[model samples]
Every structure is written in C-alpha cells, then in structure tokens.
Target: MKESITRYQFISLIILFEFGSSIIVGLGFEAKQNAWLFILLSMAGGLILYGLFTRFVSFYPDTPFPQVIQILAGPVIGYILVWGYILYFLYISARVLRDFTILISQTILHETPLFAVSLLFMIVVGFACYLGIEVIARSGELFLPYVLLMGGLFLMFVFIMDLPKIERLEPFFNIGVKELLSLVFPRGVSFPFGELIVFAVIFPHLEHPLNSFRYGVIGILISGIILLIISVTILMVLGPTIAMNSTVPLLDTISLVNIQGIIQRMDPIVIIIMVVTGFFKITIFFYGGVTMLQYLFKLPRRKSKGLIGFIGLLVMTVSMLISENIAEHLKEGLEIVPLYVHVPMQMIVPSLLLLLLFIRKRKIQKK
Candidate 1:
C-alpha cells in the first residue's frame, strides 16, 4: 500500500468527491427555475457543516474518526457508528454507479446494455482502487483541473451563444422563504455537503493530518461554488419552465447552444465532464470504504485489492436491483432517504460523537 499522496492529489480527490454526484443529475431535482439560488444557499449552509466536520477532525488530529468515536462513545457504540458510516459510503457508491449508468444509457450510448456499461465502470474503478490511494489521488490531480476547466469553457460557450437570459431568474423568491429553506435541507444542503463525512476516515491518512481540515473545507467551498455556477448557468439558459421539466438540465442546455450551427451538439462535452468526475467520486468512495473495512477488521493491506473488487461487484449488482426506474431511484436518493438516513449519519452522529468527546475530556481533567 503506497502511503504518500501529494497535497494536490488529495485536494483533487476531495473536490471530485464533493462535485461528482451533484454535478451529474442534481439539476434534475433542483429544477433549474430556482436551482441556482438553491445551490448558493446550499453552499452557504454546506460550508457551515463542513466547518463543523472539519473542527471535529481538527480536535483529534492524530486519531481517525472511528477511533475518536471508540474513545468517546465506548467500543460497542463506536463500532456501531463506524459500521453505519461504512454502510453509508457503500450505499452512496452504489447509488452513484447506478446514476452514472442511467446517465450513460440516456445520453451517450443509448443502445448499450446497462449491465455492460455498469460492469465496465466497476472494473475500471476496482482497478484504480487496487492500485492504492496514491494512484487514485494522483489520477484525480491529473484529471480534475481539466474537468473543471472544460466545464467552465463549456458554460462560457453557452453564455456566448446567447442562450442565457438574466430575466429568467426574475420573480425571485417566488417560492417564498419557507419553501426555499425547505429546498435547502434535503435536496441542496444534505446531499452534497453532508457527503463530506466520508472524509473523516481519509483524514488521518493525509501527509499532514493538521492540514486536512483546512484543505477539506477549502475543497468543499470550491466545489460548492462551482455547483452554484452550474445551477445558475442551467437556470439562465434553459429558463425555469424548460429547466424544471428536463431530466438532464445542464446537458439539455448544452444541446441548445448553436454557434452558427457548426458548433451545435456540444452536449457530448457534458458527458465527458460527467464521466471524469463520476469516476473520481466513485473511486474515492470505494477507497474510503475499503480503508475503513480494513482498519475495522484488522485486515492486511494486501487484502484490500480483492476486497475492493468484491465490493465493486456487489455495488454493480445492487445498483441494478435497487430501483425499477430512474425516477424512483432518484426519488429515493434526493427526497426520502437523504433526510431520514443520510442526515442522521452525516450530521447528527458526528455531533453526538463530538459532544461525547467533550464530556470525556472534562471527565479526564477532573480525574
């Protein structure tokens, strides 16, 4: 297991992890009409949560979150907490893989079998995981900047094509503050930002543990800003009505770009961006799950490769079995499950662990 990953590599993985899932189909649910505003508010809220999660890590710089939980909550409670997180990571990875396959089928290769596409994606991700964290991290470093730059350039083209309308964003707060705040919780805030909880496991592996909090917060902020931009871009170009109705708002908006008809059909660029970012996101989740399992079970380092492969296969199978259609899959992902399952794991559990840690510290001081 290669232990040394550069700062840039780590930063890229963090960025990819945050941006990957949201950028792909987030607009689908966000509904471009006011999606951008939701994104902005979500980012602000996400940053606050990111700060709290980072603070938790910073407080116990030398210990991984699992160990911190164990010390604070006792072995039984801590093990359950760790297991919950592990399950969360695995579920997220499976959902992402499912989402990616759905996108590919809908957009790029409509004729390809879902199983084939899913299998190929899992194979690549499994190989990357097998190569260890350093390889995955470096690959992120190499690809993420290009992905971001390309996405920016694509949006710039959309703007230049005269597709965006400032007036489309008019009638602001049309949903009222109550509805807007409600939108932020399940759709905007929890999904992307709360997902950063996975970083708790990876935090201790950083070359400089103390710096993890700084870089992690910065990474989340940057990803949020980009997501905000994407939301705004989609809203402006597609208009609220069309954007709200479209399944892939960003891709649909890209399809509308017509630079004298010669530069038309640039939706493929969106596909490229999706694929690259999706790959990075899944890889990081896979690595996080594998690492946590190994640490929890005291498995040998060399065993992670096989374990990751098994996990990938399991995810691929689960992705196929989980939902009957994309709509149902997304309904669960964006609506029902995030609030009930993810919020507790990502936000509530960590807060509980932090409180326990504080109490323990006071107890030790008194002794």
Candidate 2:
C-alpha cells in the first residue's frame, strides 16, 4: 500500500495488461480481412473513452478510485458503487484466469486438469499481488522488452516464410458503414481498451501522477498499434474467414511457421506471451479488487497480505464456477458481459461520476 511506481513502469504495465487475453483471442475479426480497420476505429473509440476515465481521475489525482467514488458520489451511493467495482474487478480477474486455463489445457497440457493449471498460475499471481504494485510495475518494466522481442520474432518469421497473402484482404472496403461502426463501439472498445479503467487504482500509486498519466495514454496507443499489426498479420496469413473462426488466430498463425522444419512449431512463443500477459492482466485486476477492499475497511499493510491470498483463492474458485466450459465462457464474454457489465461499470458509471464532479467543482467555485 505504501509502494510507488516509476513512469516507465506505469507505461509497461499498461501495455502488458492491454496485450493480455485480448491478443490470444484476437479482436475486430468481424470485419474479416479488413479487421485491421475495425481495430483502428475501435482504438480511436478506446482513446476517447480513456480520456473520459483519466479526466475523472484528474479531479482527484492524488486519490485512488475507491476514494474518488466516495468523494464524488457521497458515502452511501459511493459505497455501493465501490463495492460493485470491487466485485467486478475480481470477477474479471477470474475470467482471465479461466482464459489462460483453457488455453493451457487445450494447447500444452491436454490431459492436465484445468483446476490444476489455474491453481499453479494463481499461486504466482497471488504472490505477486502480496508484494504490492511497485513489484508488479517493476516486473512489467522488465518483461515488456522481452514481450516485444518475442512478438517481433513471430512477425518476422511469418514474412520470412512468405505466408502472408495480401490478396486475401481483397475487397477491403466491403464492410458497410453501419456494420463497421457497430463493431467499433461497445464490442471493440469495451473488451481491451475500456478495461484500462482498472488502472485508476494503479494510477494513484505512481510517483509522478501528472506525467505518468501521459505515459499511460501513450502506453494504450502503443498497445493499440501492436494489436493492429497482429490483426493485419493474421488476416493476411490466415485470411478473414479462418482468422475470425479460429479461437486463437495468433496461435494458428504461429503454427504455420515452417522454414525447412527447423524453425517450425513455434507454439511455445504464443504460449509464453499468453502466460506472461495473462499474469499481468489477472494480477492487475486482482490488485484492484484488493485495493478497493483495503481502502474501504482502512486495512493496514499487514492485513492486506492475508487478504491477497484469500482473494486469490476466491478468484480461482469463481473462475471454474463462472461458466460450464470455454464455449459458454466466450459466449458470455462476447455478447452478455459487454452490454450488461462493461457498459455500466466502465462507461455509464464513470460518465455519471464525471458529471457529478463537474457540478461539485462549479459549486465550490461559486462558494
């Protein structure tokens, strides 16, 4: 709770978190070969949504999101809203944990119990959360370069093998104005970009809050660009239909790398990216939930140590119980969660908070 992170660490964490399960599942594939365009428009929407989130934080830059809610909404209403976000964060942490669990069970550990994989992964995540935000941020700073290198290598090998078929992207503008715009708003922006709302907790931990906010925006832009490149690569290589249909398009793309057989079977690279980025994603969500609890109850640093471990178990259990299988999980995430959960927590509530803050500021000025 007493920890402080550097600006570089903040940017690295944002990039790593954004690159989480979203990359594994891919985004904007509804546009088919022109999924890149879909992603581009979504990133624009995400940036605007992010500006709204950060603007709310700017009113109370020194405070964490939980406290900001209390100040803006008053204790009764803020208490309810803060608790909602707390559960929301933990629920999402569980969801992402389930995401990696399914990926590992399907790809690497076919025979392994999904519960076993989640437990092992959650152990490391729990330990990291126990350490605090500074440690998490530092780990992200250390790993961001490695992630970039591995991601770059994957892209490089695809071209080296001459796999991309630019022709697959023919009739590029086939998407209607309505269809493209439909995908961009709630679906495209919500999943990865709107998820940055969790960073409101982490933002208050930064050593230089004002400057670090700028880095965070830059981090989102960089992640968006990386996502765009990956989307285009998948479309070019696997074509629109295949990329859209595949559960893990990037993994499928990497599986196609065959250079004289020696440079093939690069599934490990995708797995590594999934594990590393998923860790950051789940841990950040976990941390946000725990941070809210700590702030709510006024828990000391000593008490939060136990809370972290307890919450970790809760998240793991909820992950398994959240859905019947991967199909159900993805279905809920795609259709139900965005409209029902994400819009309220990420967009509606925050927008309302901003409005309240504006009124409060004017009243204070009048006084």
Candidate 3:
C-alpha cells in the first residue's frame, strides 16, 4: 500500500480491467447491431462518472478510501458504504475468475477441471496482491504492450482476410430509440465503465495525485475504443443473430479470419490477451478489497498475509459455487448485477458522495 503507480501504468491497468472478461462476454447481446453504439454512449457517461470521482478524491490526497468514506458519511453510514464497495470488488473478482476459468475450459483446456484452473489463476493473483499495488501495476506495464500487439495483429488479419461485413449494421436502432437508450443506463454504464469504482481505491495511491483526472479520463477513452472495435468486429463478422447467440463473440469473429487460406485459427491470441488482462483486473480488485479490509477492520501489518489468504480462498469458493453453468452466469451478470448492485453502489453512491461534499464545503465557506 505504501508503493505508488505512474500515470501510464494506471492507464494500462484501466485498459486491461475495462477489457477483462467483456472481450468474450459479448455486449449488447440484445442490442445486437447497436452494441457498439451503447459502448460509445456508456463510455461517455463513464468518463463523466470518473470526473465526479476525481472531484471526490481531490478532497483528500494521500489517504485511503475507507478513511475518506468514513469522514464523508460519518462512522456508521460511511463504514456501511465502505464495506459494500469492498464486497462489490470481491464479488467482481470472483465473477471474472469464474469467467476466465470457463473460457479456458471451453477453448484450450477441455480436460482441465474448472476448479483447478481457477485455483491456479487465483494463486498468481493472490501473490501479486500479496506483494502490493506496485507489483501489480508493474506487471500491467509488462503485459499490456504484448496484449495490444496481439489485438493489432488480430485486426490486421481480420481486415486482410476480408471478414467484416458493412451491411450487418443496417436497420439501425432496430429495437427503436427508447430501448436503445435504456440499455445505456444500467448494463452499459454499470459495466466496463461503472467498474471504475475500483479506481477510487487506486487513484489515491498515484505518484501524482493531481494527475488522476487526466489519467482516468484518457484511460477510459482508450479502453472504450478497444471495446468499440471488438464489438464492431463481432457484429460485422457474425451479424446480430450469431453475435447475440455466440457465447464468445470475439472468438467467433477470429475463427472467421482466413488470411489467404493460411492463418485460420487465431483464437489463441484472444485467449492470451484475456488471461493477461484478466490477471491485472482480478489482482486490482483483489488489491482494492484487501486494502479496504485492512483499513476498515484495522488489521495489523503482521496479519496482512492472513488477510490475503482469507480473501483469496473466499473468492475462489464463491466463484466455483456461484453458478451451475455459463448461461446462468451470463444471465445473472447482465440482469442481476447491473440492476441491483451496480447502479446503486457504482453510480448513485459516488454521485451522492460528491453532492454531500459540495454541500459540506459550501457550509464551511459560509462560516
């Protein structure tokens, strides 16, 4: 927790986190051709939300979020809010761990047990969190460039191989305007974008606190572009019906890539990117959760290792038992998570904090 990350390193983590499981999870599954549109709209909203978070963090630099929350809302209420956010981080880590495990099983590790895959993955994540934020952010610096390269190569192959179809985007807003905007609120805003809530914990740790707004907005924008390209590629290659139906739309899109009948199977690159980015995402959330726990519960430094183990074990168990199948997990993530957990906590809660902060500052000025 004493270590800090550079602005570019922070941006790298954001890019990886935003892309995380979403690469294959498929967006706007219902929006179909309009998925990329929602990503754009939601990302705009996300930057605005990140702006609000920047304002909030600007109130207190060099302090952790749990303490800040406690000061803002008072002991009882702030503690509850802090706990909820930590739980949110932990739950999200579990879900992503579950997602990567399943994807690995389906694509390359058919014979590997889901438990084994998740356990091994969590072990590395646990060790990273065990080391501290600097280690995790440094790992992002190491892995993200290669991930970006894979993506660029993937795009080159897709275009050179003639896979994307322009006509698939026809009959725009097929679901009508009202429904399209509706998707932007909870599902679109809550995910890839709303997940910026974790950065609240991260921002205070930056080497330059004043640079948070800059790094945060730019990071969200870059990740948004990546998500847009991925969603568009899927829509163009697979069309609406297949995109909505395919468990992993990006993978399906890559499967269609054929460079002069030579480079047909390019799914492995997607998997590699997923695993690398997914590690950063999970480790970040884990770090967020552990840091918050240590701050809120007053765990001694000597007991910090115990705290890490408890968190890792709990997330592993929750991930394994969370669902009976991938279909159920997708349904819950799309329907349940955004509506109940994401909107109130991720969107409304932070907005309220800013409102309260504004009022408190004004009252102090008047005195």
Candidate 4:
C-alpha cells in the first residue's frame, strides 16, 4: 500500500522543514536593524514560489514528481531533468548535513572530529529515510510541539532578562528600497523558502492532495511569523552591529539570557533546535533524491535497503568533502550557491514549468 499522511502531518512537516537551517543561520543581515523587513518580504516571495510548487503538484496529484516531469517535458528530456533533481536534492541534503555538523563541532563537540559527528548524524537520518516518508511525517508531528515550546521558553527568558531594547532597532530603513530589495532576493529567499522545491516529491503523499496548498500556505506563514519574531528579537537584543557580525546569530542571542546568572547558558536550546530541524531538512532532501532514483529505475518500494544504504553513504561523504572547513562551507552557501544553483533550480525552472503547463492546458481546452 502507498504511504499517506494526514493534513495535520503535512502542515507539521512544512513548518519544521521551513524552520530548518533558516533559524540557525539567520537572514537579511545586510539590512541590519531592518532585517525583520527582509524576512517579511521574503515570506511573500516564499509564498509566491510555494504557490508555483503546489500549483504544479495539483496538476498531477497522484503522480510522482518524476512522472509529472516526464508527462510535461517528454520522456527523454524529462528523464534527464529528473536525474538532475536527484543529484540536486542529494547535494542539498549533504549541504544541510554539513551545516548541522559544523554547528556541533563549533559548540559542544569541540574535541570530536566533524567526520565522527556527521557519520553518526547521517546514520540516524538515513535510517529514518529507510523507514519511509510516513515515518518522517509522524516524527515531525511528534516533535513539532516540543520544538515550539522550547523556542517559546527561550524567548520568554530573553524578555525576562530584559535583553531586547526596542531602541536598538532605530534607523530602521538603513538602506534604500532598491538596496533592501536586492538583499531579499535570490539569497535571503533561497536559503529557506526556495528550498521547499524538494517537497514536490512529498506533496504527492498527502492524503488530501487538494488541500496541500492551503496547508503549505498556513505552514509557511506560521513558520515565517516565528522566524520574523526571532530575527527581530536577535536584532533588538544584540543590536544590529553585533547580530550582523555573529556567525550564529540565534545562538548568540540565546546565550545572552541570564536570570540572575542562575538560568544562564541557554545554548542547549539552540542546539536542540538545530538538531531537530536539521534532521528534518536533510532527511527530506535525502528522501527526495532516493525516491526519485527509485522511480527512475522502476524499483519496488519495499526491500530497498541496499539502495538507501548506498545513497546514505554518498550523502555522508559529500557532506564532509563538500568544503574544506566551516568558513568555506558557509561562503559557498551564502555567496556562490544562491545565485548559481538556487536561482536556476528554485526560480527559473519552476517559472518555465508553470508557463508550459499553462500553454498545454490552453491547447487541450481549444480542442
């Protein structure tokens, strides 16, 4: 039987996945005190991109993403494109895994090798993948509340300590409209929202596929609001200069919480957020790639441990080998990947696909 998930599960996954790496890295630092504006703008951009995705999925609710590609683009070209997405998804999976392991190494695991942390992390994520998307959805549902509660608690502590000074957000429009618009595009939107492209594979599994769009919209808005609050909090607490300069802005923001020094060092809260959201993010991409490969070769859903194992190993290796160090990894992610990889995959391709779909629909209606 094909695995399916409820509408609630679907919403949970989207929220958790959106929260993924976005929380850890922070967004729109270029705008400084006005970083919140960037996230708010990017939320709109994310909704537009998401509308494209859910619209595409709606065209073929029951079909796998690869098959939809073949139907839309023809067999040969679609086969090649499907392979491209498989590689893209796997590459992104590796990138996010690297993101998490780097955080671990920098924080608590200072003495441990990154390779060891990554290996262990990948093993758990890979196991979850092997169990299937149903497992992933269920896990997301189970963990969503815990993640939200911890996040809320952290915020409460920050406020209790009176760390956030609303005055720090003075001179909100530090940059002009044109300059601020540039900061939100491609990079700001790409990191978290554009990454939702991978969910094309999972949308087909929703029990009520027609409602996927509504769930997705709600999920993004909820997560976006949460992120907006956090981003503003970071800015207000740390001030624009320090928040902009900090590597992990959220971590730094949380570390400052001190209730008479007794409730100090809330770094673990950030760590938990990273580990949970990172797992969801990486595993979704990993599953997308693995699922695409399975569909391409017409493999049976059951008894695919061998393929999962091989792909898991590949993801683990690529995570470590992708960059020389955290600096290089972040540099590639911030500077290089957004324009070249993200813009093409997340923006251009989807726009073209939607255009073609429109043309095809018109032709059929004329007949």
Residue-pair clashes per candidate, as listed? Answer: 0, 0, 0, 0
Q: How well does model 1 score by local distance difference test?
A: 0.78
Query: Over the full model, what C-alpha lDDT does candidate 2 score relative to the true structure?
Result: 0.89
Model 3 residue 145 distance off true place after TM-score fit, in angstroms: 1.0
Candidate 1 local lDDT, 1-367, one digit each (tens): 3376666777888788877877766542353456767777777777777676767666687676677778777899888877887778888888899889999998878999999999999999889877777778888889887888888888889988887889888876667778778888866778777777777766776788778767877787777778777778787777777766667777888888888878888888888988888988787777677777887988776767768778888988988987999889878988887788888987788788778868877988999
lDDT string, candidate 4, 220-293, tens digits: 99999998899899989998888877889999998888887699999999899889999999999999999999
Residue 197, candidate 4: C-alpha displacement in angstroms: 0.9
Local accuracy by lDDT, each model: 0.78, 0.89, 0.85, 0.88
Q: 272-313 in candidate 3: lDDT tens per residue?
A: 988887888788888888889988779854478888888899
Cα-based lDDT at residue 69, candidate 4: 83
Compute the lDDT of residue 182 as modeled in candidate 2.
Answer: 81
Span of ten consecutive residues with least summed lDDT in model 3: 294-303
Per-residue lDDT tens digits for candidate 2, residues 192-242, read 999999998987777877665578779988999999998888899998898
Q: What is the lDDT of residue 176 in candidate 1?
A: 72
Q: Model 4 TM-score?
A: 0.98
After the best TM-score superposition of candidate 2, give how far the Cα of residue 107 lies from its true spot, in angstroms: 1.3
Instruction: Compare candidates 3 and 4 on TM-score and give the better one.
Output: 4
